[model samples]
Target: MKSILTKPSSRIYGATRQAPGSKSISNRILLLSSLTPTKTQLKDLLNSEDTNIMINATYAFGARVQRSQPEWSIHKLTLLTSKHSELFLGNSGTSARSLSAMLSCYQGNYFLYGLQRIHERPLQDMLFSLRTIGTNIKHLFRPSCLPLFIRPLATVKDSIRVLLDGSTSSQYITALLMVLPMYKRKLGKGITLLIHSIVTSKPYVTMTLLLLERLGMIVHRYGWKLFSTCIIANRYTGPSFCIEMDISSASYYLILGLVNRSNLKLLSICLYNVQGDFFLVCILKRMGCSILVSRSDVSIYKQARKLLPLRIACHSIPDVSMVLLIVTLITACSISLSGIRSWRLKETDRLLAMTMELRKLGVVVECGIDFISAYSLPTSHLNKDSTININTYGDHRIAMCFAVISSQGVNVRIMNHQCINKTFPSFYYVFNSLAG
Candidate 1:
């Protein structure tokens, strides 16, 4: 259903709600489970399009997957036995990139394709790295983009090494990291990776490594330049695993409390979580939002005065930048955000998307290669219409961030509102519950 959210006449009081499991953790665990030769049970698995694709991809590789709400059972494939298969990943970069690397290291003939937007996303760095390790994979359409075909390698290499461009998506590195363990199991030697430049989204790579350690794998990092993994048990041993609540999804509600000056609580979300987006709370506090952290939940209460404008770099917290930008818009303050070069590679070109959309609301936004400065306009000059339409460009964050604007009493009509189903299917429901 299309959502046209209008601000409530009454103030939003304090409310508590639970977010879905972290998509990042759910997908990573799904990939790791497929490489094992035992039955694994995953609890609190995210039931979204992105993660469903990962589950189906694992099933195609001959693993058995069964779901019973909040829990899933995966039976490992005895061998990389799928001789031929076709996978259609719908705009899930995590599933496409990670599954491609896993399929390459196995004995199979596979075709990996995705939605048009996914094909536009870059995969060259990961593909090049896999090719260096002797995987017989080729890009069917563009050099770095998708529509890939993989043929079985005649012989698996004993060890692998490749240089990656770190400026692009960190998923490339994650894909490589997830697949290397398989090589170790087959050839009895580990793999080495050299990153040629400064890695953007370093926190995501750290998250990947932390998950690997939990599954009983060891990865060594020498500064940001190189990563090497030694042979451990190549397979993940799991009777059960639980995923954390999505910190990225929780940021929206936290911002709501900050903007409305009402008390907001996020259920089952912890402040000391592995998810990098958890740092958003610190950024919020720095901007003069009152926050309280406890063992059970995190709460944000609105401030009496206008929020302090911020000038910060957001390379590690890229996902939260859009929400922060929206904060700048509502308060009409000059905010400068830098270290966001990777925004261009997301589901849409977010920098361009934000600038174009904000201009429609009479906000002066300047975009650079790695920075954005938003100069707030006076309320008199701003469009005072009760209703405004926003184009979402099929990016979930764009859709959700703008939805928060509606809570301030403006009517916001979000075009392509279904894009939020990719990660947070219940976004609108949860948003309404809080705003009411």
Candidate 2:
């Protein structure tokens, strides 16, 4: 479903509604659910591409995932009588890495594999730590990458410390913590997972802790980046839990306020969001877009200013690079963004994707290997309205971000809308609600 863009009115209004479930929380809970003896009923699991991958992977790992109408059930791995499992994590980094680290403790051979994207993603950090604890895990392909075969370790009698960046992806640290309790510490205490770098995207860690608590695991949160967890046997029980809204996916609509459309009050987003993408909402609004944030929703209305030029560091909010890059195209002038070196690791190199997509729009976007500067030239469309043909490089964010770029009175066609199935399946419909 390619989006046809047109300039929006000041009032892009709609009844505020709840978006889908948080991908981060859903994946983490699914991993934990498979490990605990509790019958976990996960509600509001995202009907997105990533979560669907997780759902299939849960069943592949030999867990009885009961699905009724909308919700799902993951019978605890502890309660399961089976000892053999081969897991297939489609392309989910969180699910693959977390499951790999946790399967190490089960003391059996469980092969975890995934698609090309997962094969391309880094798992060396997780492998190094797990191997330190005596897990017989090794990559089937090149070292530090995926297609890994896991053989059960004899026994882990030692605990280890791992230092990694929270900015890269909090899943690395959280993976260790989720499987940490099964390790042997020096004094017979629970496994100690320490983050040695200044953490970015701290909200994701918070989300992890929240789900851990819901599962009844005792996790102690010390400063911003520090957290410790121990295995409390019989903690995870199969019960209903609500998945939080996805602020990351919602940012596409939130950026509509920049188009000077409507003064909407009740947008379909929440205020206290644990997702890091929420900060982009505040940041875009701060740059002069009229944004109203409520307890369970956020409303985006246009501002008097045509557009505001912004310079933001994207190291912490790496996922928002698509939205931010789209904004750069709509600006009356150039905007500079820094700290984007991590784009190389995504399904596609997002940094390059943004540049290539911007070029399609006839914008002169100069991008170094680490940073990008895009200047929205005074185009005929800004004055006379032109149509935009958006080419999505099979990247979901590309498809989603182009929807935002389409709001400028230009009929935008996003080729390969199916690419959005990578993250948000409903992206076409949800984005159309805002595009209208």
Candidate 3:
């Protein structure tokens, strides 16, 4: 599918929107809910390919899942019953890593795999940590990638020590944290995790701990390198909860308001939300956007002042880097983005993809191992063609970021526009509605 966004009108009024539920929070809550024995009522759940993969994986693990639009009722089993199962998680890294950790504690024969891209994603760090805890898991094809065969222990050891390579993905650490509480329950002792390198996406790990703490789980951290969690409670008392709107999704509209000098309000969002992408608001504010935060809403309006060039360390908030790069493009300001080496391991090589795509629009981008420097270029240097076709490489972020270029009255045709279904299926609809 190809999506064409005509240059929108300069001024947008009376634009108020709410994004879908946070995909990160939704999937984390889904996995946590499946560990409980009672029924969990989750409201404002994200209905997307990634979250759906998590839901299906939960069901495949013998949990009962029922959904009704923005709500879902999950009845979890005391223990997973399917001893022999094969799970195809598509390209969801969260599902593959989280479920791999959960399945490692059960006494069963399980196989986990995904699409070609998923196989290319890193899993060795997670697999190696699980192995330290006596999980009988092996890579079926390659050394570090997926198609893993898992045989969990019939009885867990007294204490397990895990040494993780923190440079790759924080999801590996979160996967262990999510399942370790159960392991602690079975062993009557806590699990210790040691980080051998500086962890990326640390805010994501913090979000995981926050959710676990909300569910009455105990987590202890020593500096940024070490973490330990013990099981204080064996059974989870399932509770009814509502998820916040996705801040990452809200970012596009934020950018829309900033560049277009329009007023925009995002409903069902809070200033104290757990998402690391919430930092985007502060970034925009620093870039000279006027933002107001209320209890349940955030309003952004364009400022008359110039947007100052920024040098930001985005290790904890890598997901927003794509949109931020677009921000630099529209502002025609030199910006330095650092601490994003893990961007290479995402749905695509985002660094490379962004560099390639931005050059097509006559932007100068220099990419390093873990940094990106975007030099200011006049929009006049853009291709003289009526429309620029952007290849998305099946990455949802790539599709969404280029779509923002349309706000500058530059027509963009995003190839593989359907990739947005992975997270925000209504992205274009929302964009069109607000762009008017």
Top lDDT model: 3
> For model 3, which pairs clash?
none
- Best candidate according to TM-score: 3
Candidate 1 displacement at residue 423 in angstroms: 0.4
Point out where model 3 deviates above 4 Å. 1-11, 154-158, 380-385
Instruction: Provide the overall lDDT of each model, using Cα atoms, as 2-decimal numbers.
Output: 0.82, 0.67, 0.85
lDDT rank order: 3, 1, 2
* TM-score between candidate 2 and the true structure: 0.87
Q: TM-scores, in order shown?
A: 0.95, 0.87, 0.95
Q: Please write out the lDDT profile of model 3 over residues 258-369, one tens digit for every residue.
A: 8876788999988878888899999888988999999999999879998899899998999986788887777797789999988899899989999999888877899999
Candidate 2 local lDDT, residue 170: 63
Clash count of each predicted structure: 1, 13, 0
Cα RMSDs, all models: 2.0, 3.4, 1.8
Question: Model 2, range 1-436, lDDT digits (tens) per residue?
Answer: 5543434432355534446676787888776777666577777777777777676666644576777767777784534344666666776777777878776766566677777877888877667766766778777877877777777675555445544555566667778767765453223545556666766555666777767676667677677555666656444555677777777776676666565465444333576656777788767766777776668667777677766677888766777755766766666566788877767777678888788878877788888976888887643445334456677656777778877765555566777778777667777666556544
Instruction: Report the C-alpha lDDT of model 1 over 53-137, residue by residue, as the tens digit.
Output: 8888887666878988758888876565468999999999888889888888777789999899999998887888888888898
Better of 1 and 3 by lDDT: 3
lDDT of predicted model 2 = 0.67
